[model samples]
Target: MTARAPQFCSMAWAGRPVAIEHQWIEAGPSNGPLLVFLHEGLGSVSMWRDFPSRLCERLGWQGLVYSRPGYGQSTPRPLDEPLPPDFLERQALEVLPALLQALGVDGTRRPLWLLGHSDGGSIALIHAAHHTDSVAGLVVLAPHIMVEDVSVASIAQAREAYQTTDLRERLARHHRDPDSAFWGWNDVWLSPAFRDWSIEAMLPALTCPVLAVQGQDDEYGTLQQVFGIAAAAPHTTVEVFASCGHSPHKDQTERLLDLVTTFTGASSPNHANI
Candidate 1:
């Protein structure tokens, strides 16, 4: 039998229509903390595999996983337009909050934790910095604090491989509009102005306890990314894994989950992860 196409739901953000495919796994109790998983630059909800469910079950918490606009079953971007520079900012300031509100997640009533990887990691950082009072904790894996020449080079290479190799076909399994996801992200990163992009100054605004993890073998970024978070947010705890790459949740699932469980369990000014 042929595989079934994924389904998506739509919503409005700032008067513009947006689409996002999502799944919420309820664990423990209705009042339990919410752990939101943010996917990588090229990732979607389906791309997360069983990691979110496994982590939620182990941690005894609820999980919220969704594909950002232009990925998975989410809304597709216009073919003629380039993605805005504030795409990440738009997610942090508008999309996420709108999503939570739509899902009936009350920031004032329950604790919220963010688990983000790669580009998602950067978005999580921006959200935490801007909405310090709402976020309980953060788990950033391979987040980019500043643009690096190596990152730009790797992204360029990925664009080439996607066009000339099987990368596009592979990505099609995870993205509803593969071209939208590919070009939306690829074009932004490859843009000349994007080279100087950095969120270092915004890091200091983050008040919640943070756990920054990075793989030693990550091709996209280096220890500097994780260390940058530590340096900016002194309350942050850092962990480095050997033989791991940009995707720690995928590469080092067990170890990364353990660190998340431990870090989230510890009580801080923000409500502890339970």
Candidate 2:
């Protein structure tokens, strides 16, 4: 399958004229549901690395993949501008809704299935929790519902790598401004106030079925992340991959795709899979 070119849309968000970068994977049946792929903290449409296309192909699903503002070809973050502790809240409640509105997606039209990773996953949960009627289901990979020491350490090490290693140059290949991507995520995650950030209260509000997947060896978060999801949300399933790291899509693509295909089923079946 050929990849679609990246497209741009302009909207005011986060106090600026943000350019949202997005791409379409394939066309399924006209009445088919839409699977929107949300990238990781430092991820972009390019950073998804063909996983979305491959997954969409497996399930005969169409997908919309986008790079959030300050990542990939989207609007770059202003220098010296620090994101608020409520950044994740803003993305879920403000930015995502605006993008969906611009694209004419809502509860009335075609169904929406969010496939989010890392930071993206958290955003998906928040959106689904608040706008329960807008989503059919969700498949979240390594989402952070609460802060952990392990996550903080891994991010700290990443900061070291970015400064002392070639990680900056490597990330530059996918992002227009690497600093915008890195700092946008890093600074917020490392702050003292951010450590107190938690979305557990919002969990009970999730109305749709959810599939939470994570790696056994994930450095950023522990299994509590997924377990906590199950505790708060009744309609949820958890899948843990052994010998895997933070990114299950990258470390266990074949297995992850299978899990996603089964979990999401034909239309992210609005039923329990546990």
TM per candidate: 0.94, 0.95
Please report the TM-score between candidate 1 and the true structure.
0.94
As for model 2, its CA RMSD to the true structure in angstroms is 2.6
Each prediction's RMSD over C-alphas, in Å, is: 3.3, 2.6
Note the Cα lDDT for every prediction shown. Answer: 0.85, 0.89
Please give the lDDT score at residue 56 for candidate 1. Answer: 84
Clash pairs (backbone) in predicted model 1 = none
Once fitted onto the true fold, the runs of candidate 1 whose alpha carbons sit more than 4 angstroms away are 1-9, 268-274
Per candidate, the number of residue pairs that clash is: 0, 0
Q: Relative to the unseen true structure, what is the C-alpha lDDT of residue 164 in candidate 2, on a scale of 0 to 100?
A: 99
What residue runs in model 2 are displaced by over 4 Å at the alpha carbon?
266-274
